[model samples]
Target chain A: MEITSDTHSQHISKQFNHELEELKTHLMAMGGLVEKQVQDAIEALLEGDSRLAERVRDNDKVVNDMQIKIDEECTRVLARRQPAASDLRLVLAVIRATSDLERIGDEASKIARNALSLVEAGRSPRGFVEVRHISEHVRKMVRDALTAFARFDTQLALSVVREDESVDSEYTTAMRSLMTFMMEDPRSISSILSVMWILRALERIGDHADNLAEYVIYLVKGLDIRHTDPDQLDDEAIQGKS
Target chain B: MEITSDTHSQHISKQFNHELEELKTHLMAMGGLVEKQVQDAIEALLEGDSRLAERVRDNDKVVNDMQIKIDEECTRVLARRQPAASDLRLVLAVIRATSDLERIGDEASKIARNALSLVEAGRSPRGFVEVRHISEHVRKMVRDALTAFARFDTQLALSVVREDESVDSEYTTAMRSLMTFMMEDPRSISSILSVMWILRALERIGDHADNLAEYVIYLVKGLDIRHTDPDQLDDEAIQGKS
Candidate 1:
């Protein structure tokens, strides 16, 4: 909710400030919606709630619509206000962030679809524990990434980038165990593959969350730290402001 | 290479036109690099050529660098020229296409990594046919999508969009057979899962190609046809130009 107004409040025209604030507000709403979609997706899978999963799948359109609207708004602001420096970065960040959020919504929908498939296939207990664990980790990462965007907190954004590494390792561990589980019980192959897809979706959601955090860093610090090592990110981000 | 200069050449300022043209050229180069990355990754997987796979992985950094540079150029154009209407859409489309191209690079790198794993584990021969088939299909999709972008031909773009559906179904068919192959011989589970990941990456490359084509439609006709059915896309695209 902060919207980085403390730093960006010096625009000469009230209209420009208002437009930027409105863009932030819309972005936050989109972020929150996708966050909930990710949550509901995991819950539906964990509890076998087909109804909730169906709703998650259906809501993807809503997320898609928000992305298109937000992108158009960004284009309009660029054309109208011609904001330079940090303002340009803000618009660019929003454009990139919305794309990531939409993909998160997509991954959530994938999870929901796999959840429905699992309902028909009957539950297998082998990989659900890993699913629950990784989902919770990624949900927090998504939440924190949005919070970083809202506050323009580079430190929080950096944390999310670091957290993605752990989530990835967790995914790999889960994947190995699931493969072994399927190998041990070949009859569970069909059901376990569904679970593997769900885990893959979750891992990808975490990657998207990582991307959102990187956008926040770029917006706040003027650094393009993508494809850089996470260990070096903190130093590079700090130097970026200088 | 065409760069869509036919329509956009009417700009008043030659410098602005040059900048836009440069952005397009950079985008095409990036597109070409990632397209080759996909092809080489597939070839490495099929041939079990570890050196080629390694080259594919290393070239991902070059792809990443191109994306960042192109994005910087886009932000520079938006700030300096403040291009409106079709020109603005061109910059926006380039920004988006670069992102997709970057991810396609990532997917190609993933395929390469899996290819290395397959080489280490020794080829299983079970899933190679599907891998080759889907990779050829998606490689063409990527090539055609880039060509559509370069030519600004909505018809070619639509064809790429339609081709993605077939690639997706082919993926599902491959996935089913691979799963059955694993259930038949649990000893092959590990290698088969690597192939599955490779297939998943290929399917995702097709999706990115679909996105690139959608951007062309958006760039040419100003239609936001994402999430719309492909069957109706042509009508909507034709009507969008009206």
Candidate 2:
């Protein structure tokens, strides 16, 4: 009446696969929440809506919960299945990705807070249009980074890295304009500072997007491109394209 | 002469222990390198030394290499040993910590680059002294976070999270000051923007420190305090203290 060794092995393998798939599903779920937070934070900035800002803050809790849940699940799998090699890499990557996504959520929350403060301070002066430009640039970078992650597209991920330079340039311009504004009128300094916070938050978001892209590169190519000559990444991508 | 079952079991256990120790040692080595990078990056900013900036930039390669090597070692151990339970958590934590350390290195590199750019722009205006305050605060946070990580002091880690608010405040002040300066004189905008870049980098360093602290908390308590109520962490720490 006892189960055969073959049957037991098959059952264990099935359970392991199910757990691994669940881990991926949970990570993707967390990614969805983080992506939504980023979108809403930017939308709040553009619309000057404190309500949306509140919503982003509220959702951070859910994202945090998912992170913990996913971590526990991964650890449980590691203990139960003791997966090796490629499976181990996937598990490790998920753990790292969860942290990155959680930080992305934090950045979004910061942006929301900044947006609320900006609305309270009133609209920025004329030259502050640069803030909008930076925001749009960063938002696009984040969007593309997430897209690259979802599709496992290293090319798109590399493009996100390349675009980081543009975001940096925009952030530089915005800072200069804001600095000039602060010096011109100390009276509006507080309000102007609020706008700067929003801009800074957007910049951080761009950085997080870059982190996500780096993960995509690691996931797809098993390459540690973190400190490499970004030019090398581009060259490799170019070769692949041809 | 065939080895007995008892002998084989003891050999395997000994091998597992050795691999676990090696993983820990490698993680610490990587941690040390990343911590140095963060310190050097801050020093570069404070001293306005482009040479130091270049060194930090180059050292990122070393950090990246360590990450890949440590990751590979962890994978090898996982594959060969099939570690379970606490051992599994330790391996996974090392993998996660390596990633956080790599990012901490990146943030430091960014600070160095900002310093280099600031130097290129000539001396910052006298009013930009607030950057010094931010620099000191961020440096302290990074140091404390790394210390907490090394000691596995959850209390210190939680304190790092609490201290982030002060850094956030300093960043806000710096942003407002920069914005006012930009509004006053468009001519000084570019130089002031460079200053803001430095501030932004420092703020991000503080953020990374907070992240390290979060990881430390996870490592010690096996609880994910991220995105949860800060009060929850505080209460837990207080209980631990009592």
Candidate topping DockQ: 1
* Model 2 chain B weakest lDDT span, ten residues long: B233-242
Q: Which lDDT values do the candidates have, in the order given? A: 0.91, 0.75
Q: Per-residue lDDT tens digits of candidate 2, residues B94-120?
A: 777777778778877877887788777
Q: RMSD, each candidate, Å?
A: 5.4, 4.2
Which regions of candidate 2 are displaced past 4 Å? Answer: A1-4, A124-193, A234-242, B1-4, B124-144, B151-196, B234-242
TM-score of 2: 0.81
**TM-score of decoy 1:** 0.93
Measured by TM-score, the strongest candidate is 1
Residue-wise C-alpha lDDT for candidate 2, range A35-131, written one tens digit per residue:
8898898788777888999999888888888888898887877777777755776676677778878888888898788778777777644434776
lDDT of 2 at A85: 58
Residue B37 CA displacement from its true place in model 2, Å = 3.2
Best by lDDT: 1
